[model samples]
Target: MIRAASRRGIRCVFVQGEDVMEQLKELIRYEPGINLEPVPCRCSECNGELRKVEEGEEAILQDKSYVPMAKIGKCDFWVCKTCGRVYWQGSHWRNMRLQLQRLTKSYH
Candidate 1:
């Protein structure tokens, strides 16, 4: 048998998106510091690792105007090494964080 990701230098992992979301809420269901830390680094759009790209590195930004750079902090830039999507934390990110916080708190 063959797998698409096993062709050469590729790798694969299985994730039940909803499953983890549920688990995070379940595992830290009533933890107080749940909101003190930032979310894990992964492509929100594709769940890929967000690699740090130095200046002059090439990347295809899906939307040039919406590079949400200030939502997280300074040096707010990363690229999804798998899908080539660029990201910067901004307003939408704050909203998502708040929602996740609510989820973690509501478990009590």
Candidate 2:
């Protein structure tokens, strides 16, 4: 598959992993310089660029239910202009960071 893509002037990577974290590790192993750290620059659901939701601009969200009401004014928010999906660094964000750190240490 990779060879076929290469013939067509495209680059491809074959990643082997049972889950997302493992897949990320494999990607890093394939390319040591790749940045695995989370960045809110793009939407996870779609490849759309994300725009930071400024304070008082929360009303732009089409689906408010995706966000916790209590966190509205407490944390930074990013919205996908194409899909209108909201993103925030909630509790799971810490766990993801920890996992990335472990993955990085294993490689370095």
Which candidate should be chosen as best, given lDDT against the real structure? 2
Pairs with backbone N, CA or C atoms under 3 Å apart (clashes), candidate 2 = none
lDDT of 1 at 10: 53
Query: Highest TM-score, which number?
Result: 2
Candidates' C-alpha lDDT: 0.60, 0.82
Clashes of each: 1, 0
Give lDDT tens digits, candidate 2, residues 1-108.
679869999766788798988888788888877777776887989868898999779686535776887788888889988998899888888789899888888889
lDDT string for model 1 (8-83, tens) is 6554333334874665565463453544346447887888898766665533442455554333335556778788
Q: What count of clashes does model 1 give?
A: 1
Residue pairs whose backbone atoms clash in candidate 1? 68-88
